[model samples]
Target: MSFRALLWALGLLVAALFAASLLIGPAGLSPSDSLAALIAGRGEAAALVMREIRLPRAILGALVGASLGLSGAALQGYLRNPLAEPGLIGVSSSAALGAVIALQTGLAGAFALALPLMALAGALIAVLILLGLAGPRGGALTLILAGIALSALAGALTSLVLNLSPNPYAAAEIVFWMMGSLTDRSFTHVWLALPLTLIGWALILPLVRGLDALTLGEDAAAALGVRLARLRVTLVVGVAACVGAGVAVAGAIGFVGLIVPHLLRPLVGARPGRLLPASALGGAALLLAADIAVRLIVPERDLKLGVLTAIVGAPLFLHLIYKTRAAQ
Candidate 1:
């Protein structure tokens, strides 16, 4: 299929899934009821279901998924490693730790800014640590090792914090949040993270050309007039902003970043420049579908988004690893 045709098809699929999300919640409103509530502006219960519940979840899913996809694409392009991902590099874990700290300290409860600020700080710290460990001339293996070290440290800290919490409710909340779900999210979350995600996308979109250049190697990119130092700073900040806000809201949902970009790469002809936007759309669609599936599969139980994504993503990851090893 032509690129345009595939884009159109994905667009339609996203719309259909979104509509299904609205209609098929625990409340189980039909399409007619949803439409009537939307059109007449009545049915307080239906309106509550659509407006106060599912709509925000859907919007947040799209935003979070888009952010993950774009950040993943940028990282893979910048690092020249197709396996590079936000979660693998400890960025998401660090962000989640930051948000968890904010929540546990009662700081985030007082105001809306605490969670996002701390999450961004955590992601920045992770990136700085990775850069220091890997150094300027480090190869793909060095970077991967650095990322693994950082991820382990962050995970240990998160566990320690949860273990020591005085409030059992807070600890339980932290554990559930870490598992990651979009259930019962309010519009407050949508408003809190949307601006930051938008700014992140703006920064990364311009870097697509830089990424394409870098794919030819850092020296080639520099020779081609790409300012390597400046591009690296911009890419790091962009990923931190996007992924931090996402982790702050949704709490470390993985594999959207890893799987979306990898799956869409071929569709975009394997060009990083073309792959970025396609990954954004594809990721949005994938998360929306997953969110709907969670609602349908078990309406009573709280189905974690991260669990669903992991179920789908783990096999794909293993296959990619095998392919990489075989090629080597």
Candidate 2:
């Protein structure tokens, strides 16, 4: 199918999934009932369920998914590596650690915005360290290795904090949050992350052209009038904001950013410029679907969204590794 056709199809699918999300919750409202409740504006239980729970969750899912997708695409384009991802490179892990600290220290309890703010700070720190380690003119191998090292360091720090927390309950809570789930999310979360996510999108959306230029090689991009250093700074900031806010709200959900971009790249003709928007839409759809699936798959248990995504993503990673080895 053509890129336009795939985009249209994916858009329709997202709409359909959104409707399902509204109507197919544990309380079980039919489409007709949901529509009636929405239209009547009465004190109906179905309306309350639709409005208070499912609607906010679905919207938040879309926002989080879009943020991850866009950031992933930008990172891959900027680094010129298909394997590049925000979480894999330590951005999301560091952000999660910051959020965990905020939560454990009671700062987040005092102020709702503390979590996202702290997470953003952590993300920026990780990005700066990664860039400093990679240095200018660093090759793909150096960057990847530096990212891996950063990720390990962040993971160790996160583990240490969780272990040393005085309250076992808080430590347990940190484990659950680190696993990444959208269950019990409310409008408060939506309000906290939405503004920052939107701002990040605005900053990154204009960089698609620069990404496209970089694909021809950074030196070639410079020749084509792309200011390499400035663009890199913008990309890093954009990814930090989006990924940080997302991790703050959703915890450490992995692989959506990595998987969504690559899955849509083929349909979008493998062009970074075209892939960006498509990946955003596709990511929203993918995560919404995954969230819904998590609820439905084990309704009693309430499976985490990240676990489901990891189950799907790990095999794909293995396949990629195999392909890389074969090519070598």
Choose the strongest candidate by TM-score: 1
lDDT of 1 by residue, 1-328 (tens): 6778877877787788777777777676778888888667579999887888888998888888888888888888777777778887788889988988887888899988888878888988987777677664445677778878877887778877876889776656655555577888889998878877888898888987888887788889899999989988988888898888988898887788889988888887788977787777887888888888888888788888888888888788778778877877
The positional error of residue 276 in candidate 1, measured at the CA in angstroms, is 0.7
Ten contiguous residues with the weakest lDDT in model 2:
134-143
Candidate 2 per-residue lDDT, tens place, 87-136, comes to 77788889988888887788999998998988888888988877777664
Taken over the whole model, the C-alpha lDDT of each candidate is 0.81, 0.80
lDDT of 1 at 120: 84
- The collision pairs in model 2 are none
Q: What would you estimate as the lDDT of candidate 1?
A: 0.81
- lDDT, candidate 1, residue 59? 89
Candidate 1 weakest ten by summed lDDT: 170-179
- The prediction achieving the highest lDDT against the true structure is 1
Q: Which stretches of candidate 2 lie over 4 Å from their true place?
A: 135-141, 163-168
Error of 2 at 216 (Å): 1.6
RMSD to true structure for each model, in Å: 1.8, 2.1
